[model samples]
Target: MTDPTPLTSLSSALADVVARAAPSVVSVHSHRARSTGFVWKSGLIITADEALADEGEVRIGLPDGSTVAATVAGRDHTTDIALLRADTSIAPVRLTRTVPALGALSVVVATTRDAPSAALGMVSVSGQGWRSLRGGEIDARIELDVRLRSSQEGGLALEASGEAFGMAVLGPRRVLVIPTATIERVAAQLETRGRIARGYLGLGLQPLRLDDGIGAMVMNVDKAGPAAAAGIRQGDVIVAVNDQKLSGVRALLRTLGPASVGRVVDVAVRRGGEPTSFRVTIGERPEA
Candidate 1:
């Protein structure tokens, strides 16, 4: 085999890329209900799918000691992309028409780690898509290795020349940042909707498996919130919402949609050993 090229003397150009893009990178944490009656925090960040993944009370720590609330604006499942909003503002990283070639050197940064971490690696693959274990296939994704840590999700990865190439999302030690261009398109959709917000029902649910049906079994209810006010109680089997059958969490999200944000809706559940219906007015998610 021929001798390999020296990496250290590559060029002055590569150094500039890391310096320019690292600041814009961020870390995200999301909270979900668990069987223990407590909330658990996890990260599956990157700029995409911001709405679905709970980056609970996002605290973006900038290099300049600035921390701002990062809100989930919108997400397009077809493309697996989500947009986020920050009040302090950032000098949005610029993009290029050209994509990173295979084996291009890049750096990834996690702004939300217990102690921030950085890694150096090369793009092992590009223009690839994978079906998420969560469902839905993400396309035009770049796969690289930057020695990512647990909280590195939703961080930023940059080309050696500093132009933003993508944002980090997943893998074990391998990192994948969906291309920045795709993120821009989804952010546009979020902007049209005004601000990023989520709704809360204050009910805990467990998936029910049955031969002829699919549903969630209510394990607990927020007694002081909408679910309790509407007569929802633990042990209720939610079979449907507003006429639409509930299949799973994804289906439940669609049923809520954007229209549910302040409107009262009918919820069908099996309570007290009998089928029942109740109307609950959806409530706004608390500001982080």
Candidate 2:
């Protein structure tokens, strides 16, 4: 008969991790919708912004079966993270800065109606850094091989050691783990300013090949946009931004981060077989 010790030990270890992380997990209720959130700090909770409705009041259900009223301290739609402040206190989960290895054991701890529940999975994808489809800069890309319910969107992604790798959110088609570095960075800014500022160029572009290499082909220009004001027109191939060679749409979007707003930068483009440069000022993206 095969030894059962290994399987028994693995089950016990996972139970211990869930026990340690359960106190930090809470059910967040906003405008009749329910989701999960983890205590980021004393009186502070972090949740998925997309799960939150544009309502006035938010409530947090604690492990002790009591609920506390919470206020929306800040939110960043770009990163899909929201910060909530409450009067109650709970032990915050320990966030690990180290990235988890691919195929490593990971757990998703979520709050159910009565108690905290856990789901088992493994790290399926890991990368250094990347941008989201909406142009948000993610410090590290981590994806899990688990299917999560809508209520588990803002739950914790914990390593086998019980250290939090990040917060789990439902992506376009799969589950995405927002790394700890990104959570900390965005949370700090949101806690301070209540919103993240993003730079906008106001030009629709498509990836196209130029004589030198790959470039972004401008498809449409906003008449009142900074790009239009700087003489950027349709059919122009943008090859470089601030002297950095552009390879695709991702590179251009990555370059236009929050800091690029209002900054004047040189854009190199190929027009009629000759390289031309245009000085354009970045603008703020209009709120949706």
Q: What is the C-alpha RMSD of each candidate to the true structure, in Å?
A: 9.9, 4.1
Q: Would you list the C-alpha lDDT of every candidate in the order shown?
A: 0.59, 0.89
TM-score of 1: 0.51
lDDT of 1 by residue, 128-242 (tens): 6554444434446688866655565555666776655666666545677667565554455456663334456778889887555887888888887788999898999888888
The candidate that achieves the highest TM-score relative to the unseen native structure: 2
Indicate the TM-score of model 2.
Answer: 0.80
- The candidate 2 region of ten consecutive residues with least summed lDDT is 250-259
